[model samples]
Target: MKVNFKLACPLLLAATSAFAGGNNEPTAHRYISERIAQYGEAVERCEKIAASRPLPDESVIEQLRDYSIDDVRIFLITRSSLVSEICEKPELTELAYAIGVLEGADISGTPKEIVQNIKQLVFGEATWGLKKKYLELPVSVQNILKKTDYFDKPFDDIAILNAIENAKKP
Candidate 1:
């Protein structure tokens, strides 16, 4: 019993020391919230600059670069004529969102795959359609999709489909 008690004392000490260090690390939600707050501040700064000076697209892009909204960087591109070019392809948004998900630390591959699975949602009728119908729109979504290599070729249609199926499950 004395030997057992001596062994238990070290284990208890180790556990207490571990718990003392555990609370020092920031939680996942806190990290994400901090990143979002930074992005929001950058967006607000971009909006202010745009409001103050009616700059051309190049200038606007440059201004956005001056602020560090790294996550929404593509949206800055999308909002420009670049988007007109980008939306011509169906997959740009899908690929971009996928890449964003992959790059973000908090997001899992499943959620990123889920974002990719919603390809049709991103293209909307404004862009994707039959080639003839697509051309009839101001721009074609296919062109945008092609430009971004949205699916990154060798495609993962099954993975995407499975992701969608899982999402539908209650």
Candidate 2:
């Protein structure tokens, strides 16, 4: 017995169409906002865990790491004023900066401006491994890192503020 091919083609197409893009996919703004909220919640959970002991829980670190490089970059750029808070948390800060360096954030502006932004973005000190990773970044990013004086000394809040103020000069 021969099976009819025409009848099967429409059935196959209908089956695939049902699984196509759906309303479940969020809009760009919604997606960004949701990711940011999740990041904030993860940071808060980590902070609470840290407050109860000398170190934060490993699960929180894993949760934070779940966010993609783009998620971290968007978080940093949108919530820039929270840099100090992010820096104070070593695990979160490291992950955020590492993602930024790895993803090649557009470190534009003059040396001082770039330095000031880096200072704000990375308020906490980077580990030797992270610094090595930063060194391995593209020349454009490396040049920004070098000009930021990241290796000159440990991360100093006062120094960062001073640099930011100095950058505003004509």
Candidate 3:
């Protein structure tokens, strides 16, 4: 059977969530919750900034987290929701999406695909300006970018944005 990887990814994530305790773990989401708590201030700060300053590329910054693959998935899910209820804009959420994409590509994808993905992300993921805004990204998103290595090179939002806007993708 030919499985659709895109559709299967969410199903796989659901299965992973369901079996979160299959390994005799004490808590499936305790770490996640604690991380949110740990970075609570930073996250709120970022959200506040995003709300007060909706532009993505402005010279500013807030929000936070230390995480794993599963954590990124959770962040993607939850942060997406947060844009509607907690924040006025989706810059932080979009950053989460970018991190998720880059992380997934890092795990399994080609350079060409990642190039295209990065290009796409820069387009709608935020306001067009990348200089000041990229510098002001939330602590959590920055950490993820640093962690998600592309071709063994760390993912830099400014560099990727510049590549997409000025130079050839990748």
Candidate 4:
């Protein structure tokens, strides 16, 4: 018998949720809760992106390099609904986060915290020590770092400091 991986993914996630600990709830309840938490995180990210000031039509057009003014305006207007859509679809979290970064969202955490969170989201919790993995980060993250101003300092210096600061956080 052939197993369908797409159908099995949710079942595997639900089964794993039962052994994740920290609660005595039934397996189904725990699975639901885990999914809800994931959705909540995704929504929070989208909300942060939506809260950023809308880029001027000219700026958006320039930054996008391809989109027309009308398309940019539509994209900006529809951003608010992204939170609800992301919340309902946890699988889109990575794409949502990437878009938020590109859109210059005001992430709630400090730079160090934000980097750590991104690292965890992209590479999993096991990949500690940003210095070691700096070059290994996804292209999206590298692009964001390049776009971010670090007061003329080298990216490595800023990345190291952020890593140290992240380690100091509780």
Top candidate by TM-score: 4
Q: Which residue pairs does candidate 1 place in steric collision?
A: 88-140, 88-141, 88-142, 88-143, 88-144, 89-141, 89-142, 89-144, 89-145, 90-141
Winning candidate number (lDDT):
4
TM-score of 1: 0.25
Q: How many residue pairs clash in each candidate?
A: 10, 0, 5, 0
The positional error of residue 8 in candidate 4, measured at the CA in angstroms, is 29
Alpha carbon deviation, residue 68, candidate 2 (Å): 36
Model 2: worst 10 consecutive residues (lDDT sum) = 1-10
| lDDT of candidate model 3 versus the reference | 0.34
Question: Which parts of model 1 are misplaced by more than 4 Å?
Answer: 1-26, 55-170
Residues 95-166 of candidate 4: C-alpha lDDT, one tens digit per residue: 345434533534322232333433344334332333334444444433432443321211122233333345
TM-score of each: 0.25, 0.23, 0.20, 0.26
Q: In model 3, where do residues sit more than 4 Å from their true spots?
A: 1-15, 33-45, 53-170
Task: For candidate 3, write residues 1-170 as lDDT tens digits.
Answer: 01122233344334434433433232422332232233333344544444343222221111112333334333333333333223323443443454454445423223223324433433344423333343455566546435432212111223323323342224
Quantify all predictions' global Cα lDDT against the true fold.
0.33, 0.34, 0.34, 0.36
**What lDDT does model 1 reach?**
0.33
By lDDT, the better pick of 1 and 2 is 2
